[model samples]
Target: MASRTFSEEDLSCPVCCDIFNNPVLLDCTHSICESCLQKVWRTNRARQCPVCRKRNSRDKYPLNLVLKNLCETFQQEIGQRERYCGLHISEFKLFCKDDNQLACLMCQDTRLHKNHNFSPINVAALKLKEELKIKLQPLQKKLDTLKLKDPMMELPNI
Candidate 1:
């Protein structure tokens, strides 16, 4: 028997066109994101199923934990996969300056990104990470000072 392969579309919420977050199962046996259902309820002022238009007996939509778990797993896998170059089938290790996007070596040589100035993606990422650490240093110092002064003090919003 051949195993079936599923795409991100299969796990996406029809209303949001994104991976389901806080998915809920309707009485009509349809699953949708909980936030999408809330939007419909708020706009239409009715407890109707978004997919089937069936009048729901209860106002509250129970969380579809099984679907929610599947969506989360799918999203994580997608995030990891997105870092790879789709055309070159290689890891995106270069950042094209003209395009302001990451690309693989083969992608950089392609007509689309040819003649574009490039830098190592890892170097750019490391520089950005270091900058972020430097920027957060003041906040960390303030937090430490606040902790030493008063353990129960309310923090002032910067």
Candidate 2:
């Protein structure tokens, strides 16, 4: 079986436009942030589904534990993509040109990277990608030659 992919919208609360925080399931089969639901109920003076406008007789709704867990895991996965400094627990936003390494703002202030030139992570990533592409051209040509020599061989795309 294959794993399913969920977009940010799938996990987001329509009221808050962000990931679900303490989500609650309504009688109408819709889910919303608990706080957001409370705010809407208070403002409108009615217990109803915000999305479908369906009136709910019950005052309390069940907490969507499964959705809450999914939202937390998704947030953690996103955080994992952005490298963080172990020492300061800050996101790496810059690349130290002299050291050829990623650095957080705290690391930039330290003496270890003193006087070293730095570039934004995006800029550094683009520069490195271009360099890698240039370096791989000859290797790619050689692989093409080999592929021609052995037509039956299935080489993985680089």
Candidate 3:
């Protein structure tokens, strides 16, 4: 089921629009953030929580593990999609052996790579990944050296 959430613009939730991290089930069964409940308690002396109509407890509320995991998974999927080729100006489908180019399904039938052997993008991507890994190694080593190097270098003037 899709999670119900308050609008971020509405200022109903500080962390997210819905699926509160530390959800406190009010007596009425409505859920709100534990922190939000505390804020409500500080402002109101009413015996019940405003949303759930439940009796207030002094102890801090426990975190909702299910909601936290859901949020994390959603965020990860979003991050993965943002890195996808569909969002890129260049579409990803066929790989040109000649130019090592990635093109959409349309580009393959066109004059762009008629003579070249076309391969699946995943295959080309594997080689490209190895190339990128090798290229990045030097930069990573330099970064590691910089991190370990002394801030102050002892030098005698030439």
Candidate 4:
């Protein structure tokens, strides 16, 4: 049997369209981000999932920090997981800056490009890593230099 693959679009929350943070697995086994649930509860009396239509109480939308952190870790290891895509259940991708969305490559070259800036998976990953290295290298070098310098000879903290 052929194995399945997941894209960034799969792991994002439907309401906010962000990677799952504080994921809450409902009684019906449908998961929703705590923040999205909060938004619903804020503007609603009976908060229900937009997907499963399952009823949820306002107090139940507490953030699940543990699950949130876990997803973050996993997302780094694997950019996207087997979560469902909110927009296109059949297709997925990291994110499209041009369209301000996460969608399959086929969605590109569409009228969404009129006022959008679409980018690819590798572009975002590489750009972010490069930017971080550029910013962090100098700071790390400074820290090492300070550690090597004598405390008495160093200037006082301003």
Candidate 5:
């Protein structure tokens, strides 16, 4: 058997198109946010699975604790990946030009970074990307030349 990987869509509620908040599992085996389910039920005036339209007889459904926990964990992981600073456990909002590194606001006030030039993370990222593109141009041209010299050197399309 193959293991399946879940994405944000897999953890999201069909009704809200967002991560599940207090998700509830329907008899049809579909999960939806509790608030979104309430809104749908009120508007439709029916107890049914929002995804499949399968009628549900129960007035209340049990919360999908597993799915809820998965969603929360996924969100935390994504947040940590985005801009989190491991040292300070805070978001990286600035780029330290002197040290050429990302830094949280707390790092800015530290003695080590005092008087160091800083830029917004997004601005610094764009500048770095542009610089990288300029640097890679020559390398890319060389690779293209090599490919032309040897047909066997051609890379497969992803």
Candidate 6:
């Protein structure tokens, strides 16, 4: 069986759209950042879930320990891989498509990428944006075709 790779976006909170910070699971089984939930509760003054709008009978939300740990690990990994090169300690301005890795000026001059295809990070980002747009087009059309029969209808399990 092939293993699935997960990105930070997959673990992000729906409310803040950031990697889960002190994640809490609601009665509706939706996970959200604790601070975001608190802010919602404070503003709404209700136990209603933000995503599903399901009312919670209990005030206390259980901490999603597994998700919290995963988010922490993800954040640490991202922090370790910031703009700087791992070996050269210089800013990464180029992305090597051959190795699917970011490279700094020093790293790009090395033999590892001598024959490899390289693009500036900004240009690579534009290409990725276009690719994402092409991928999302079909999904967007499918979403447009969907129609709701009832306002209170429960969402399907993810």
How many steric overlaps are in each model, in order? 0, 0, 2, 4, 0, 0
lDDT of each: 0.82, 0.89, 0.62, 0.66, 0.88, 0.85
Could you tell which candidate, 2 or 4, scores higher by lDDT?
2
lDDT of 1 at 109: 74
Query: What is the per-residue lDDT of model 2 for residues 1-158, given as tens digits with 9 covering 90 to 100?
Result: 12448888999998999999999999988999999998999977667687898898888899999999999988887778568777787889999999999999999999999999999999999999999999999999999998798765665667
- Models ranked on lDDT: 2, 5, 6, 1, 4, 3
Tens-digit per-residue lDDT, 68-131, candidate 6: 9888877776776687797997889999999988899888889988988899999999999999
Selected candidate, larger lDDT, 4 vs 5:
5
- Identify the candidate with maximal TM-score: 1
The C-alpha TM-scores of every prediction are 0.61, 0.54, 0.40, 0.40, 0.53, 0.51
Clash list (residue pairs), candidate 5: none
Q: Which stretches of candidate 5 lie over 4 Å from their true place?
A: 1-4, 84-94, 97-158
lDDT of 1 by residue, 15-39 (tens): 8888898989888878889899888
Q: After superposition, how far is residue 108 of candidate 1 from its true place, in Å?
A: 4.6
> Across residues 118-151, which tens digit of lDDT does each residue of candidate 5 receive?
9999999999999999999999999889878777
- Per-residue alpha-carbon lDDT of model 3 for 1-158, expressed as tens digits? 23436333322344345545566555554556777777777767764666455676545555555555555666565465543355333456778788876666766777756777888888888988999999999999998888767454444547
- lDDT at residue 129 of model 6 (Cα atoms): 96
Error of 3 at 32 (Å): 1.9
Tell me model 1's lDDT, rounded to 2 decimals.
0.82
RMSD of each: 5.9, 13.9, 8.3, 10.9, 13.5, 15.7
User: What is the TM-score (0 to 1) of candidate 6?
Assistant: 0.51
Model 6 CA deviation exceeding 4 Å by range: 1-4, 83-158
- Most accurate candidate by lDDT: 2
Q: Per-residue alpha-carbon lDDT of model 4 for 1-100, expressed as tens digits?
A: 1233555666677778888987876655566787777777688776677788787654664455655776676566454434335444434555666545
Worst 10 residues of 3 by lDDT: 6-15
Model 4 segments beyond 4 Å from truth? 1-5, 61-70, 78-158
What local lDDT score does residue 77 receive in model 6, on the 0 to 100 scale?
A: 68
